[model samples]
Target: MIGSLGLKLARFAVVLSVFALWEVLSRTGMVNPRLLPSASDTIAMLGQLLQRASVRSDLAVTASEVAVAFVLAVPCGALIGFAIAENRYFAEVAKPLLFFAFSIPKSIFLPMFILVFGVGFSQKVGFAFFSTIFIVIMSTTVAVDSVKTEYLTVARSYGATTAQTAFRVYLPSMLPVLLETVRISMIFNLTGVLLAEMYASRDGIGHQIATWGENFQMEQLLAGVLMIAIIAMTFNELVRWVETRCSHWRT
Candidate 1:
């Protein structure tokens, strides 16, 4: 508990130090206010942005794209992961192909997505789904392979069927890894959605940020960034808490 508290305090201190430096830089004109707004101004503008209906709509657009992409990726990723993990020869062939594809940055395909889907939410969801699915598949396959053979043997001795053994033994053991993959994919999913919006979109959080930047609305731009940070931090904590809860049965 004390260690956790100390870590929290350290994180808080770092954030405060950064904001303090930002405030000083803006106030002293060391940083151009036109390009980098004061921390206070950004905070104030963030509150205003939250209160605006148009901004709320943009947030909703981004949120919906993320939700659709995440929903599509999870089951598909798990299926792919299980398939590869269950077959060594197939895994040897497919794993390299999957990794090779994953190594290519999602940006490389943004133009293709835009060309295929045009500048709208479909492209955003598609981009996010493709970008995030690989993480889930890679993590799940590794986790499945790492499951203890002893656990499966014990289940078999107890008369557990193959399905029961997998669900009751293997999956429980791999839960932490699966949740960690979700946490990681959540971040990348958002990045893909935002990149889509920034590249071309009629509306969304990313489009709003880009609009602010183009307009030289530095304070609003920073505020938009802060909003993204808040969203990411919220989901990160939520996933981490669930991961911690699931881990309690492990050790």
Candidate 2:
């Protein structure tokens, strides 16, 4: 307990130190204030931005896109991954292709998505889904493969049916790893949505940030980045807590 508390304190101290450094550098003229706004100014700007109806709407739109993409990606990826892992021939043929696709920069496909879906909510969601699904598929495949052959053998010895073995043996074994995959996939999904929004869309938190940068609005730009950082960190921590809770299922 003490160790955990100390670790939390250390993380908090690190974040506080970063903000302190930002404040000092900007206020003391060590860095140009126009380029790097003071932490206080950025926070103030974020507060003001949050109060605006348009900014709030943009935040909502981005959130919706992320949520929809995640919902669509997880089940589809898991099913595809499980199917591939269960078939040796398919695994040999598809794993390399999936890895090659995953290695490619997903941003390159944004224009194709735009051409198909236009610069709208569907485009952002589709791009996000495309970016996120590959990682989830790879992770799920690994998780399914990690299940022990002995467990399956024992289930077979007991005359367990395929469905029974899947539920009793595979599900328990894969749950923890799948939980971790969920956390990682969300990061990809959020990034894809933001990149789509930034690249083409007229309205979204990402678009707002891009606009602020293009207009040389340093304070707004920094504030927008800080807002995204906060959201990402908070969601990561929440998923991590759930992962920790589910980790006991791992053998």
Candidate 3:
């Protein structure tokens, strides 16, 4: 209890120090106030932006893009991961290919996505899926592959079929890692969607931020950025809470 309190206090101090330093820098002209608005100005703008229905609508659009990307990625990733994990020959052949593909910056595909999808929400979803799907697939494969041989052997000794062993043994063992994968995937999903929006989109929070930036509306831009950070952090915290709840049942 004491340690947790101390940690929380330390985090608070760090945040406070950062804001204080930011304000001082802005006031002292060490940093360009036009580009890096003080914390107070940013917070005020954030408050005003939050009250706007249009901002809420943009927020919803970004959220939907992330949701769609996650839904598309998870099952496909799990299937691919399962296939690679279950077969040693396939794993040896496909793992390197997948890793190489992941190494390729997914943003490079954004232009093609925009060309194909035409600067719409579909392009954003596609970009996000392209960016995040590989991580999910790789994490899922690693998690399933790491399951103990003894556990599978025991299941087999009890006459468990492949499907039974996979669902009853492997799935349970991989749950924690799967949840972690989900958390990570959401973060990337948000980032990718935002990048897509910023790159070339007519709507969404990222577009708003881009518009604000182009106009030199530093407070508005920072507010949009902060809102995104808040949304991502909120999602991460929720996933972490779920993880904590399932911790006892994971292994």
Candidate 4:
């Protein structure tokens, strides 16, 4: 426990040092304040931005897109992944293709999404789903594979039906790993929504950040980025906490 706490503190110190350096550079004119605002100033601007209804709307739009995408992606990915993994032949044939697709940059398909969905909310949500589903599928496959063969054999010896074995043996074993995938899926979903909004849409936090950059509003741009970082970190920690709780049996 002490070692873990110490490691966390060390990470916090590194982040604090980076912020301090940024502040000093901006305040001392080592870096132009107009281009690289102090961390405090950027945080202040974030507070101001939050007070604006438009900024709040943009945040909500992005959040909703990410939520929708996550909802669509997780179950579909899990089912498909489980199906593939359950069949040895199919797994061998498809794993390579899936890995190749995962390696390709999803950004290149943004133009196609824009063309089909017209830079609307649907486009953002669809793109986010597309971006997140592959990772979730990959993770789910691994989670399924992690289940012990002994568990399955025991279930069969007990005369368990297929559905019973799935629920009694596979699910309990996979839950911990699947929970970990939730964190990864959220990250990919959030990134996909932000990228879609930045590339084409007009009414998301990503779009607003892009606008600020185009207008050379460095404070607002940095503030927007900070807001995203905070939000992402919060979700990541929340998912991590849940993962830890669910996986306590492992310990």
Best lDDT among the predictions, by candidate number? 2
Lowest-sum lDDT 10-residue window in model 1: 31-40
- Sum up the clashes in candidate 1: 0
Candidate 3, after superposition: displacement of residue 226 in Å?
1.0
Decoy 2 TM-score against native = 0.94
lDDT per residue (tens digit) for residues 111-216 in model 1: 9998999989899999999888998899889889879899888998999998898789988989998889889989989999999999899999999999999998
lDDT of 3 at 247: 68
List the candidates' TM-scores in order. 0.96, 0.94, 0.93, 0.95
Q: Residue 199 of candidate 1: its Cα lDDT?
A: 84
Candidate 3 lDDT tens digits, 1-251: 56998999999999899989999998888999987999889989999999999998998898898889889988788888888888899999999999999999888888999889898888998889888989998998989977899999999999999899879988888888888999999888888999999999888999999999999899899888888878889989999998878767655
- Residue 141 miss distance in model 1 (angstroms): 0.4
Ordered by TM-score, highest first, the candidates read: 1, 4, 2, 3
In terms of lDDT, model 2 sits at 0.95
Which residue ranges in model 2 land beyond 4 Å of their true spot?
249-251
Candidate 4: count of backbone clashes, pairs at least 3 residues apart or interchain: 0
- Give the candidate number with the greatest TM-score: 1
- Summarize candidate 2's per-residue lDDT along 11-83 as a digit string, tens digits: 9999999999999999999999999999999999999999999999999999999999999999999999999
lDDT of 3: 0.89
